[model samples]
Target: MIKKDVLFNEFLIRNATPEDAVQMEYVQQQCYPTLDPTELLNRNHFINHIKVFPEGQIVLERDGVIVGSASTFRCNFPTQESTFLESSDNLWITNAHVPDGEWMYGIDMGILPEYRGLGLSKEMYTVRQEICKELGLKGQLIAGMTIGYGKMKEKMTIQEYCYALEIKKFTDPTVTPQKKAGFRWIKPLYNHINDPEAGFACVFMYYPVDDNYKLECKL
Candidate 1:
């Protein structure tokens, strides 16, 4: 009679502490084979994150082992199109979280390869949405990774691909999931994730504090 999703019934989510940095780093290395620069931020970076904004760090666990992570920070999200994900990551590294800022910018989010399809990601995003309302924040600004574009680049322009996804003409492994979780595709971002195969492009997306769209991701 245990009440939980039969697939991920034992999994749980919680705030991250400085001590969890090592395991979080392990999740990153296993999830992102793209050698994302954030992978370089092991101990100090994670410690710095918790030190400055404890509420912004979180980890997903199953059977006492960390399998996924999402890192964020409060900031005055730039309206200019020039701002992107690198800035979000650097803001945390330099302790640049703007106190009382209105937006929670997602610095990173990833799940271990084996842990995918368990509804862990949308669940984690729901955590962020709850936090946003609790903190009186406006919404979330996510420079979503272009995980789908790497293969489609030869077939069409990056802009065209994102446009297709925006209108639901096509779905992406990375962006589609988030979009289904109530995030809207704003535009195709340039250089959001540092991957050459993807042409360093990603889609800029948003979720409001009052978003009513429910994800198919049942917990």
Candidate 2:
């Protein structure tokens, strides 16, 4: 069984605790340097996340230092469709977190810039999928930032960019990686966040629990 903590390539992946809030805040700052200051989750927000839904708050550590973290909350689909600010309850993640909600909605996931491209995110996504099965929930849902759109605005519109991503015509730094990690495009979310780097747009993606891809968990 892959207990609460799992070791992979010298990295420790486990559920996050309130104490990790400081490091999480730092990591988030480095990951989204261009994002608005008001939108970033502070230390208090991280503490609230763990308090509200410990199982959905995960972090990755290397050499006993946190380098990546992901935040999620439970909610029912269709009925819970709302922008990031609304769904995340302005980063508090309390009011919107339904204890018995049917799906896990991912609000944030970030890896320090220096730690990128190590395939660590796949581990995070796997854990979320595993969490779904463990809780008997539907699956995972997210509004992914179109991080590559800002540089490509002169080339195509956000809609065209997402369509291209779906057809594999091109890839986005953020959305493509999530798609590779097993999330399928559900739609595009304009003004989802105040992210200029993403052209202020995000892509709605979903990863169902019953998908064919097998989980690598030895448990």
Candidate 3:
């Protein structure tokens, strides 16, 4: 077993290996219970994706145990098909939607329940930003999701949730926590599904991996 203290002290960020597939699969199931099994990519899928683009998938280890994970792939507007149906035809839209040579990163970041409220999430972004800089990427784009858990039932609409939370967007708030980490709101897109409460809103956010951008942990 991995030592918890050692794991938490250092930022063990690196590409996801085939060995990490099983652990990452378990983490996703535990973190997103409501996600459809079909929608969740299996271990083999992660292995394939990493084999082609190792830098795209990232995992965090506390000592030697996996505690968090995130993945980023080269993409354009609409990010992913699940978030925007048009994303499936990326080849066609690439010429029109994307600039002459600009590129975006589709990101999915999650942390184990126990490790949350810490700066791990922000650190994950920091790693991603560094990769973006190394790759000479223009911007980091993401579609944020908002699922109303049992305790969050009252905040029904996106506007209502933002007002209550005092944040500008739903997925990652536009306030201290996210903004201080070097993120900014782009625009709100359509919802992923029909159900308002359970549906996920496609809010776009971007971070430029420029020298001015600083990645810091609040907690």
Candidate 4:
């Protein structure tokens, strides 16, 4: 276990390198049992994202050990179905489409259980937002998870087993912590289109990286 003072006093936040991918993969696997950790850690994808947005891909280290990881990048409106799901068509209409601008997207954020609840997650978000501001980003967008979707389940026309496994519940304590850091829930977005069994509901959240948004930490 990490020491109390060490958890509160100081932590290292830096851009993740290819060397950190293995440990990051471990952290993701430990944190999200239901999700496929390998998908995020695939060497090619990890390298591609890092090469594309090195500053946006970050990791938290404590005593030289990788304990948490997050990746942020510019995301445009959903012109196509989510890569996480199959099927070519899109579903559900919402006025909350992504507008033209350099909108920041928080793609993944995870921390190991032993190091959780120590305010490190929020600190990581702060760092991400700072990076966005430095890059002249306008807003940050996220597709948050949701639960209690009985009607949505029927609309997708999927079975119970697939539904239970695929449909993510809203209010994930892991991601919701971002609200305190400066995000506001925006609208609902779909993960899987037309597949009720695998379809998942997501709440979009936005946080403007404007002058009015104060930073609690020095960048």
Candidate that scores best on TM-score:
2
lDDT of each: 0.74, 0.85, 0.57, 0.57
Give the residue spans of candidate 4 off by over 4 A.
Answer: 1-9, 36-40, 77-101, 147-172, 191-199, 211-219
| Clashing residue pairs found in predicted model 2 | none
**lDDT tens string, model 3, 1-219?**
111222346757777888998888777767666655544545765665566557667888876888877755665444334443334122122322333234455545777888777777777777777777666776576655544422354545555554544453444322235555666655544555333434555445678767475333111
Candidate 4 C-alpha error for residue 96, in Å: 19
Which pairs, if any, clash in model 4? 146-169, 146-170, 147-170, 156-196, 158-197
TM per candidate: 0.86, 0.91, 0.71, 0.67
Better of 1 and 4 by lDDT: 1
Better of 2 and 4 by lDDT: 2
Candidate 2: TM-score?
0.91
Local error of candidate 4 at residue 148 (angstroms): 8.8
Model 2 misplaced stretches (Cα beyond 4 Å):
1-8, 212-219
Worst lDDT 10-window in candidate 3: 88-97
Deviation of model 1 at 50, angstroms? 0.9
lDDT of 2 by residue, 24-91 (tens): 99999999988889899988999999999999999999888999999999987755346778879998
Q: Tens digits of per-residue lDDT for model 1 on 1-219?
A: 111232446777788887789998888777767745743446567778878888878888888788888888887756466434356555353444787888788877888989798777998888888788889997787878778788877788878988788788978878889988878766677665667555678777778886674223211
